[model samples]
Target: MRRLRCPYCGAVFEVPKGAVYAVCPYCGTTVVAKTGEEATRQYYYPPRLDDGEAFLLAVSRARMLPGAPADIAETASLARSELHYLPLYICSAEAWVEGCEGAREEREETWLATSRLPLPGLEHGYRFPVVGREPYDPRRARRGVFHQPDASPEPRCSALRARVEYRAAGEARLAGCRGSVESRAGLVGVAHYPVWLIEYHHPLAGQPLRAVVDAVDANLLYLEYPIPLERRALVLGGAALVLGTGLAAAAAVGLAAGSLAASILGGLVGSAVAASPLLATGLSRTGRYRYRPPRVERLFIKG
Candidate 1:
């Protein structure tokens, strides 16, 4: 037996074993029922840590310069974090459409449709499969409370329907397969993923830096760092020295023999000087950082 909550009347009801669909006695809404086997086989992600603490851990590791800021440390220490389980929906369907191309007067028109026909007596069908899994592991605990599913199933299903509509309009053969509208294939469900959030103290300044990563995926999400005014000046001065020295050498060579070697040497020096700023800019944009428990491992759900 399984318990069901009515979407229309908010009534609760007990569904008999093996029942697929049940009609709400009070509100007349058709609710799909899950089987005992299906209910027991679903996999869930366990919550590891609260959002605020996770954020702090991440930021601490995202190396800020020495003597950064006091405010940065305060902000990192006072932030909040949240945990959630999002849902992902999947579907398989047949699509048909009509389209046209060319000029209006002598336009070419075509009607195209493909169907698997569902094997005569087979009715419309839907199946939800477990694709990728994200588990929360705050302390590397062997057991923990799994986060409840929070994402609505309807929107996910609607996206899938839109994809089917779009596919039907395109010039392609519809084969037997499962698909999603905006997400990657083989990702049928978007279950809630875990993440660690961190705020780190900047020693020089009074401000803190923010960082986030997928606890399960170990994918870094955000990072921010500032470059010192002195470093910027140093880069500019170095570039000027490289350019001026090269130009002076080239002039000397021209006065001596007007040789190709002088031109080649000048060009190389000029290119290096011109490219220095770009390299420095790239480095400044990507600030220094590190993470603990660094290996990324994919989680798979068997149920």
Candidate 2:
């Protein structure tokens, strides 16, 4: 085993022979065992939420769901709450195409979260505002689980380099010249982002529903909430009313026009149109619980 000290926290840990990376158990910093200059440093974002605050936010988000019980915020029981630090790799690359006349330069950046766990709503295009990032510290984690990076950052950095080179080549082509690319990956860093996994239960939902929130920004990422009986009844009643009214209107028109065919066609059209919305609603809220965010937006740290 090779022993390596974490650059950010100075915690010494051992990695298997020929291993590339290992996360420091003390500070949760992913340290590279080799490739000194090419390796990226690791940092973490401090969590802005506490246990009580995270649970309250989850309850509030649940109450905001469509057809949610009015008393859910008051009556829901907090079952479990867990804090986790997920790893995200930030890779940047810049390329310059050397042409006969001039050179064209292009840059590319990408953020990739490399957790194999079943975390929902954590995908590419989710931007992390590069602010308030400090050196990884276990004390600041507040007893949260520091999930190790499941994948390496090299592939992502390579992809970024390819993108930069492609863009540079395109620019050279537009300038009426073919060129060769000179590209290098830059600023390869891993950031451990804080997340809250909250579970709550209400009598209406039978089972506990989970909510994932960004601890730094308090933005709800994923949510599962119970559907209120009142809303379900209202939807059913409205559908019935619309169906009956349309059938009556169709029958009246048929009687006025003295044509059964027109009545049948009108009724069919009316039924299809009226049922479409209701069917969609029902399908979306198929079970007692629904998984969706009320007002979703990009979650990032305050600059």
Best by lDDT: 2
User: How accurate locally is residue 259 in candidate 1, as Cα lDDT from 0 to 100?
Assistant: 82
Worst 10 residues of 1 by lDDT: 103-112
- Backbone clash pairs in model 1 (N, Cα, C under 3 Å; residues 3+ apart or in different chains), count: 25
**lDDT, candidate 2, 146-190, per-residue tens:** 665556667777887887777677667767776577888865577
For candidate 2, list the clashing residue pairs, or say none.
Answer: none
Misplaced by over 4 Å in model 1 are 1-44, 47-53, 64-78, 83-188, 196-208, 231-303
**Model 2 worst lDDT window (10 residues):** 284-293
Deviation from truth (RMSD, Å), model 2: 7.8
lDDT of each candidate versus the true structure: 0.41, 0.68
